[model samples]
Target chain A: MEDLDKELVRRARLGDKDAFAAIYEHNLPRIYRFIYFKTANRATAEEITQEVFLAALRAIPRYHDEGFLVSSWLYEIARNKVIDFYRSKKSDISIDEELEERPELTSTDFVKTMETKIEADKLKNLLKKLPEDYQNIILLRFVEDLSNEEVAHSLGKSLGAVRVLQHRALKALRKLVE
Target chain B: MTKERIHNLFDKAKEIKPSEGFLSRTRARLYEEPLDHPRSQFFFESLHFGATQAGIYATAACAAAFIIYMSSSISVNEKQSVAMKRTEQIEDYKIDVTLKDARYYKEVAPNVFVVVSK
Candidate 1:
C-alpha cells in the first residue's frame, strides 16, 4: 500500500491528474473524519476536506518522500487547514462548545445520522477536553490507527515524543472517562 | 470507561463520513480546478541557474584575461631585454673602434693622436 501510494505520488508530482485523483479518493475519508472531529460540523468538515485536497494537489510537486505514508502528509495539511479555519473564524468557541451548541436535527434519515452524530459527539466530548497535542496524538494514533512514525510525522514530533504524548493523552482521557 | 470502551467509541466514530454526494461534488470541483505551480519556485530556480552560469562564465573570462596579460607582459620584457643587449653591444663596438684608432694614431702620428685623443 505504501509502495502504491508512493507510485501515485510520483505520478502526481508529474502532473498526472488521475494519480492525484486517486490519492484524493484514498485519503478523503480519513481527512474528512479528521476535519469533522476538529470542527464538529459536517458542512465545515466537508469544506475543509475539499480545501485540504486542493492544497495537496497544488503542493504535490514539492512533497518529498521521507519514508512516511502520504496519509501522514494529508493529516498535516488537514491539521493546518483546521487551524486556519478556526483562526479565520476568530471565534473562541471550542469544539466541545460547538458540539453543545449544535442543533438537534430531525429527518427521515435520523437513525443513521443520529447514530453517527452521537458517536462523534461522545468521542469529541471525551477527547476535546484534552490538550491540543494530546487530542491529536489520540486521534491519529488510536482513532486513525496510524503508526507511531506516521503520527510523529503528522504532528512534527519525534517518535519518542509521540510515545510520551500518547501515554499522557491516554492517561488524561482515562481520567476524564473515570 | 476502560480503554476498551474508549476504543469502541472511536471505532463507532469512524462510521462518520462525508455523504456520497459531497464526495462526488468535491472530486468534480477539484478536477475542474487547475493545479497551481508556484511561480516563486520557478523564478528562484531560474535565478539560481542564471547565477551559476554567470559565475562559470565570469571565472572563465578572468582566467583568460590573466593568461593573456601574463603572456603579453613576458613578451614585452623579452623585447626590452633584447633591445638593451643590442644597445650594450653597439656601445662595446664603439669602444673597440676608438681603442683601435687610438693605437694606430699613437704609433703612426703622435700629434694627430693627441688631437684624436682630445
Candidate 2:
C-alpha cells in the first residue's frame, strides 16, 4: 500500500491527472464516511468531502517524501476540513436544518426507508452525540477498521494514547447507545 | 449500550456508502480545476506574470547595483586609510642618513623632507 501510494503521489506530483484522480477515488469512501459521521448530513458530508479532495489536489505538489502514508495525509486534511466546516457554521446549524427541513416522506416510502436505513441513521445520531474526539476514535477504529497504530498516525498521538482514547471512546459510545 | 450493540452499530454504519454519481461529479470537478499545475505555472501564464517577472528582475538589478556601490565605497575608504598610514609613517621618520655619496633626509610631512636623496 505504501509503495502504491508513493508511486501515485510521485505521478501526482509530476502533474499526472489520472494519478490524482486515482488517489481521489481510493480515499473518497473513507473521507466521505468520516465527514458523514461528523456532520450527519449527506449534503454537507458530500460538500466537505469535495472540499477535502480539492484541497488535497492543490497540496499534492508540496507533498514531500515523508514516510507517512497518503491516506494519513488525506485523513489529516479531512479532519481539518471538518473543523473548518464547524468553525464557519459556528454550530451544527446545518445538521439541525437538515433534520428539520427534510422533505416529507410518503407512507409507503417512509416504511421502506426506515426498514433499510434505520440502524445506520441511529448510529449516525448516536455517534454525533458523543464528544468530537470520542466520535472520531470510534468511527476510525470500528467503522473504518483502522488499527490503533494507524489511528495514532492519523491523530498524531502515541499508540498507548490512542488505546486509552479508544477505550474511553467505546465507553462513551456505549453510554450514548444505552 | 452493551459491547454487542456497539459492534452492531458499527456494522451498520460501515454499510453506509456515498451517494451515486459522486465519482463522476468529482472527476469532472477535478478536471475543471487547474490544481494539477504548480501555482507558479499559472503565475507565469497570467497577464501579470510578465510584469511580476520583470519586477523581480528589476529588483535583482537594483540589488546588484547597491552591492557594487557598497564595495566601491569600501575600496575608496581603504585607499584613504592607506594614504593616511603613509602620512603616519612619514611622521615617524625623523632620522637623516647619508651613505655612499647619497644624502637621505626622512620626510616628516608632505613637502617637508626629513630624508632627501641626492
Candidate 3:
C-alpha cells in the first residue's frame, strides 16, 4: 500500500490528473467518514471532505515523502479542515444544531426503526461528548481501522503513547457504551 | 472490557457514509475548479529546482572569483617581498678585502660588485 501510494504520489506530482483522481478515490471514503463522524452532518461532511481532497490535490505537486504514509499527510489535512470549519463558524453548537436540523426524525418510520436510529444518535452524541483526544483515538483506531503504528503516525504520538491512549479511550468509550 | 465488545460498539455506532453521488460530485468540483496551491507549497515546487541550479552556478562562480582574486594578490605580495629581500641583502652585504688586494671583481648589480681574491 505504501509503495502504491508512493507511485500515485509520484504520478500526481507530475501533473497526472488520472493519478490524482485515483488518490481521491482511494482516500475519499476515509476522509468523508472522518469528517462525518466529527461533524455529525452529511452535508458538512461532504463539503469539508471535498475541500480536503481539493486541498490535497493542489498540495500534491509539492508532496515530499517524509518517511510516513501519504495518507498521514492527507489525514493531517482532513483534521485541520475540520478544525478550520469549526473555527470559522465560531460555534461548536452548530454541529448540534445540524443534528437537530436533520430530517431523520420526521420520517414515517416504525417505532422499532425510530428506536434504533435514536440509539445510533445517542451513540454518536456520546462519542462526540468524549474529550477530543479520546474521540480522535477511537475514531481513528476502531472506526477508521488504522493500525496502532498508523494511528501513532497520524496523531503524531509515539506508538506506546497511542497504545495507552487507545486503552484509556476504549475504557471510557466502554463506560459510555454500557 | 473485551476488544470484541468495543469493536461491536464501534460497529454499531452511526456509520454515516457519504451520499450516493458524493464521489462524483467531489470529482466534478475538483475537475471544474482550478485548485489554488498553498503559497508555501507553490513556492517550494516552482522555485526549488530552479533555485538550486542557480545556487550551484552562483557558488561555482564565487569560488572561481575567490581563487582568481587570491592568486593575483598572492603574486603581487610575492613580487613585493622578493624586491624587499633583495634590497635587504644589498644593505647587509660587507666587504672584508680592499679593492687594491682584490684579484677579480665581478659586477653583479648596478654600481655594486663582489670581489674574489685568487
Residue pairs in collision within model 2: B105-B114, B105-B115, B105-B116, B106-B114, B106-B115
- Give each model's whole-structure lDDT: 0.80, 0.76, 0.72
* DockQ per candidate, 2 decimals: 0.26, 0.24, 0.18
User: Which ranges of candidate 2 are over 4 A from the true structure?
Assistant: A90-116, B36-118
**Sort by TM-score, top down from the best:** 1, 2, 3
TM-score of chain B of each: 0.44, 0.45, 0.44
Q: Which residue runs of candidate 3 sit more than 4 Å off their true CA positions?
A: A90-120, B1-5, B13-15, B35-118
Report how far off residue B58 is in candidate 2 (Å).
41
**Model 3 TM-score, all chains together:** 0.62
Clashing residue pairs for model 3: none
Top DockQ model: 1
In candidate 1, stretches whose alpha carbon ends up further than 4 angstroms from where it belongs are A90-109, B37-118
TM-score, each model? 0.66, 0.65, 0.62
- In terms of lDDT, the best-performing candidate is 1
Candidate 2 lDDT over residue span A51-88, tens digit each? 99898888987987668778878888899999898888
Number of backbone clashes in candidate 1: 0
Worst 10 residues of 1 chain A by lDDT: A94-103
DockQ sort, best first: 1, 2, 3
In model 3 chain A, the worst 10-residue window by lDDT is: A92-101
